[model samples]
Target: MVHEGVLVESRTMRASVAEHTEALDRAKTLSLLPDGMHVTTRMVADYFEVGIEAIRSLVKDHRAELSENGYRVLTGAEVESFKDLTSLDKYTGRHLALFTRRTVLNVAMLLRDSIVARHVRTNLLDTEQWARTASTTAPVDNSVIHNLVAWLDARIRETVAHQLGQHDARMTRIAEDSVRTVIGQTVVPLLNHAIRADDERRREISDIRREVAAIDRALRARMPVGGMAAMDAMSWREFEEHVAGLCRRDGCVSVANTSRTSDLSADLVGRTADGRTLVVQCKHFAPYRKVESGEMQKFIGMAKVEYTADIALFVTTATFTPAAVDLAVRHGVTAVHRGLLERWSAGRALQVLR
Candidate 1:
């Protein structure tokens, strides 16, 4: 017998029963796309009878596992192309996250709180055991999984072809690489492994699929690589909030965004682990733009002199210009350009604060 929280906590058990997404229907009716092959985040949240934030939180924590089961965010022309194939509302933003039935099942296995998710997990476990016993003698039907895979593959090829705009000589290589990346790298190898392996052996395939997803994400993503890539998408106001998050993560207490127009232009203010005043100025600029000497000079003096900051940080998605870097060094401010910002956001300790 499975323990009470076994399915919610055990990734291996989840994978074993994930194909049994029929369990979800037992919990509640799932509203899928017109084609019945995909569902929006809202749909998943509604079916689980949880708040939308609950679904988003689960995805945030277990994206890799959910992604392996066919959750993906569509961007740019891919969004338009996807809408052409099926309706998507304006509020989806520039990027839209979609999920397959298997993806929903993966969520059911991971989510700990929702009553519907718990019901689905329980049903899935029971179904899994019965299927194994049945398959030992009778011929098990594989039509559901087979049809889903076939339709999903064709749709992926269609979307990638359209989104990459595989035209003109210049874009040909890019299109080929991106298409080959999603299809060739992600799906094909996993499908082959699933076909060859028995149920127990499929556990080993999970880690390999995760690695494949990482590589595939890098290739197809419009998002930049590394920690700060997400910063590119943030508004200036949101950037301040993000820095506050980073500061808190690194053990700052009472961190808050203090965006102001005064001589002390610190966007964030907090204290380090040792209670030293920490101040930060964030420049949410494009990569081509640099933190100029004037901006750096203003911040350096204000953070150190006006605010009496012990740790002054100048962080930007864009790098620092030579003059700005020199001034920051002279003033003892840590100039976190794109590379250093990436390192910091990726969880490396800010060496200076320590």
Candidate 2:
């Protein structure tokens, strides 16, 4: 007795009945942003009576299906372009995800455990039921015209069956031949032309890419050696970003720069390719300054004791003092001093830590 539209658990069925998006309005009001055409992630969360993170998680899980129904993420230049279009100047984030009406309804169908979503499904079922009842059951008059209509229907059914019953195989063959003829006349030639042109363009693009790569290699050869001077001139914030990029380049997954986090200031966190947790605290100091033993001890407490990292590294532009070096060796902390950092920046891996 359950309708397919009410089966919110099935994504396929939900998408099939996405035209019933008006059911969302019937269930509850869907407030849109200034544009009135698209809704932000926050707006969608508010409509569903859920948290913004919940909406983000749902989008991540059903990305492809939701994208097909017009869910989209805008970033960088695209975000700016959208801001200009919508005049939504309040948003200053790097990324913005917008949802169309169909996309929100799609979420409703896929979302469970929300009273609002349940009400939407109920309205969807009602719409389907109303359409069926309204279209299929027309009232008839009890008169002579009714009898004539019934007699005509019976005669038409009987005559159609008698004439077409023996021609079923011939009809099927005609339908298949028509389909093959249409495909041969249109689809096959278009496909062949498209494939040939695409292959030729691909070869030309490959040649251009190779030339660009050669130019990039030549440009790099002319740049300053090791680029250590550039690091010394960089600001503290820039240094933190540069070191995090190095960690990412060395086959680290989920490498994050937690410079703003209070627990570990200017820390690079990720897991190595071998599945060991790596934590690096960057010290963007002058090469003339030396890291003292007291600073090394504090780093050990934060990186090892607090973070419980498998590979705890203290990377600095300055060299460690003799006492600091001894403390680092005793505690198994890989102290990446100025010399080691230069080698690392010059494309050498931190094999000692691994």
Q: Which candidate is the best by TM-score?
A: 2
lDDT of 2 by residue, 81-146 (tens): 767544467899999999988999888887776788888887777666656644654433335445
Top-lDDT structure, candidate number = 1
Q: lDDT (CA) for every model shown?
A: 0.75, 0.74
lDDT for residue 117 in candidate 2, whole number 0-100: 82
Candidates' RMSD to native:
25.6, 23.5
288-315 in candidate 1: lDDT tens per residue? Answer: 6878999999898788788899899888
Where does candidate 1 have its weakest 10-residue lDDT segment? 219-228
- Clashes found in each candidate (C-alpha, N, C closer than 3 A): 0, 0
